[model samples]
Target: MTDSSVDYGAVFKALVAPLLVMTPDFVILAASDSYLKVMGRGQADLLGQDFFAVFPPNPNDPDAIEDYLRASLERVVATGERDFMAVQRYDLEATGRQGVFEDRYWSAINTPVLGPDGEVELIIHRVDEVTDLVQQLGRSGERGVTGARAELETMRTDVYVRARQLLDVNERLKQTTSALQEALDRQRRFVFDASHDLRNPITGLLTELEVALSEPDSDLHPVLRKSLRDAERLNDIVADLLELARLDTATPTTTEPVDLAHLVMDELERRTLTATVLTRLDKQVVVCASRIRLARLLGNLLANAERHTTTTIEIIVTTDPPNAVLEVIDDGPGIAPADRERVFERLFRLDDARRQDPGGSGLGLPIAREIAQAYGGHLYAADHSTGARFVLRLPFAA
Candidate 1:
């Protein structure tokens, strides 16, 4: 089935801001109408030209405007993040006069548009011209310079510094706005997935109960058992969801030094699995973390390995200097190279994962990773020769 999508290029071109879109190599592609109007340039003047060649630094100012702008654009492409520049003084060539420049001040931001391969394919340069305000300050100084020239010059310098400070505050506000938008998008997706997951077992339980109620003389035992299983599944999902929500708050928790090797031994003794388990633990390896949460993290990893491994599971614990490292390796079908990272996303499951363990709550890995990260540690799926391998690293207790 085909899907409908927006023409983002058209939307970008019609944006009501002074925007210049360029290639990664700094070649100008399209200029917004606002940009053309502000710079007094035609489409033919900017399209297909080099960005720097068209808008060179003011030859009059000693400050390196071109260098600053280039560096900002390079950073956007390199880090795939937006770059905001402080208020800058860049002069433009006069419309009809040769070798004459017009003073301009601008607060600029550059953002990257990444392509499918996660490479920066295009950059959108946005500028808000502040020349009028700067020029007004300059004129204010000139008006009072008749008797106190030096004092007024100092006042103008102070006003310029204040203007830059205000610009920085505005940039921070913009960053906050972007962050809130992303958070809202993530929340929306999370709600949708949660609702879908909850609806399934609910529908099944209601259907089975309704059928048994309608048939008074039928064997209700089977219906009750099925309903009970669905209810249990639903409960487990809700519990996992609650655990994830708690982890999301990221509130600081009191911690104590916990022996890692001994804790693993205790947790292993509690579980019964079909696969053979092997352990290679380093004694006296300890870490500072909540013991309950650490057990939950370890439990999730082991449960996941139990669900996927074919015959054998290897548990290793060792100290790598400041870190206490743990590895959980299994002999099941290994994770695909592309899916190692996506496995930790909440509610995410591969086709093989769903078939291997239908009753599994997909939140286990995400919750495990969150728990590790809460303690300033890391958890990730590592490449394995046979099946799946998970590695966890936590700071050794000081």
Candidate 2:
């Protein structure tokens, strides 16, 4: 086709974006002046040659340009599709310049040019080169990485400052705990001293009352006996408080192999609750734990169950490959979901159940849980078929 025959040639040439027309077989039929200049090639040189033969591939691979052209042509012909993008780097052999890396992410529109019978005679290929925009993005990314490094340094400084603050807080906590422990110790010593001093007076009063009761005129014997009972109860409370303080301050000792199954069974037998004891002891379920602490853990659980339940409590001792499981179940009223967790807190008794039973100190379960954790174990309440179930899971012997 002659340039004169095209009515819109001058207008199309005035457009800023590069445009080109090519044969279905990729022969360069025509190109705008901008296309020729951008590509650094002359219209005369490009006119009859295949467009793919005009540029070399990226130096990283020699045949990439040929592959790109073949794929582009196949896509256009097979699907009547357009809008393809690719980044190509090439050496301009005609210019004799070292290869310029061009990121030409181009978008192409393929239109089928039709003859009178509506048969496609040629393809009109139009493209916009977005290399400059892509290069600007690369520069932006380099700046972003530098900014990110500066931000990371700031974060490190913040972390160090926060760490110093936490260390100061921890040291203060240690001091507070030490002072509190000393106060508790003094309180325990006062109770022990008072109890010891009252013992002699209490004994002397009882002896005199016994002597008076033997005489015929003693109506005060009953009053004296009642006073003695009150004194004994007070003494028991004081002793228990002193024991609790000692336990609170005691340091943990080295762990050793303890017969956990035997310890549990002995505690159950002591209560004699008419409950069936199922023991599945793994002959050598030897765990690293303090013996006294383990016994206390087992005893507290057993006693808690016995106190709440009137009839039967079942104790199951089992060992998995890596964990020892102690499950105690009672047919008493199951703990309400809300109170289940709270019941394990120190001095926290639920108003529903423990309030009715006047025997609990409310410290049993919490002590058990503390002991369990000290030996690398955990205690939790679980749902059972008809009762409250407590499970103690401990790490098995290595």
Candidate 3:
């Protein structure tokens, strides 16, 4: 008998395990029948949708599981390896409900499928819904054990499984925290060494240049002036590095209710800009943050806009309910979608930035983001129709 062609797609759909196939970029390609049944979702409703869009993070939960899910999927794509996620609390949109969601607990694993070129093509996401088991266990201590022998045995088995999972989760968290702390320490040491090494040489050069330029009849006036500027730029680089090193290891000493709109207005007023500055300020937007750090954050943003802006720089401050929002927009070459996230990487500069400001230290945006994150906020390059937009979101003051 001739070998028959296999129906792999049908077999995948009919698999006992709940699974979803998504592209590396997280567009849902397909879902298993088990997955559809478990999620209470129609196949048509999920296909061709972005994963995050379909299951947006639960805004009320500060420790959002979507962040972990996204990070795990990204790691799978990057490493071409499977990632087993710790049991997480991710609520699901309720069936037949327009604006309601149900609590969910899930154990998931993401595995990457590689193409012929050995690159990740699609990610296979497998999830096991353990919400019922989790809820039962949470109430076990309060309710006491008043069940049949078989029921109690099953509960005991589940408790063992959950204990093992928690142990694994704690180990992973410990390892990750340790690795991150080590990397941070290394970075801080490097920054300190570089700053210490450069400061004295730069100071000496600047002083010698000033002494030379102070001579009235010097024939090297033009050259000395240029040299002085170069030395000053070097000094600025050392200063920036020191600042970044400090921020990397420091926390805000004092935080108070700061009117965000007034802060932006004050920052704008203090700056001298080549581009026309405009604002749409909401005066009542307030956040609890260090005034000094907020000033530095705003200064970096405006300085960044000034560097790339051709004619107009706009600053907008408004309240977004739970958070106060600030947007700095420039009418210049917008950031490429790929570079938007990379722009916040320390010392990572785009080609346009290099040409626009050759002397830039490239720490401005990174420093700004560090400040934002320290205050339980976020700084990110947002999509804009005309030019580049940088948005800062900080929780509102109590």
Looking at model 1, the pairs that clash are none
Which candidate number would show the highest lDDT if scored against the true structure?
Answer: 1
- Per-residue lDDT value at 138 in model 2: 44
lDDT of 2 by residue, 37-155 (tens): 77777788788888766665656644344454455565465445453433333324545455654434444455666569655566666666655554454444445655765565555
Off by over 4 Å in 2: 1-247, 274-282
* Each model's lDDT: 0.87, 0.66, 0.83
Q: Give the TM-score of candidate 1.
A: 0.75
Prediction 3 TM-score vs. true? 0.53
What's the residue-level lDDT of 42 in candidate 2? 78
Candidates 2 and 3 compared: the better one by TM-score is: 3
Candidates in order, TM-scores: namely: 0.75, 0.43, 0.53
lDDT of 3 by residue, 141-232 (tens): 55555565456657856764685568457657856976898899878765675565466556667776776769757777665667777677
Stretches of candidate 1 above 4 Å error?
1-26, 29-47, 53-87, 91-147
Q: What local lDDT score does residue 353 receive in model 2, on the 0 to 100 scale?
A: 50
CA displacement after TM-score superposition, residue 221 of candidate 3 (Å): 2.9
- Which residue pairs clash in candidate 3? none
Error of 2 at 240 (Å): 5.3
Instruction: List residue ranges in candidate 3 displaced over 4 A.
Output: 1-174, 177-218
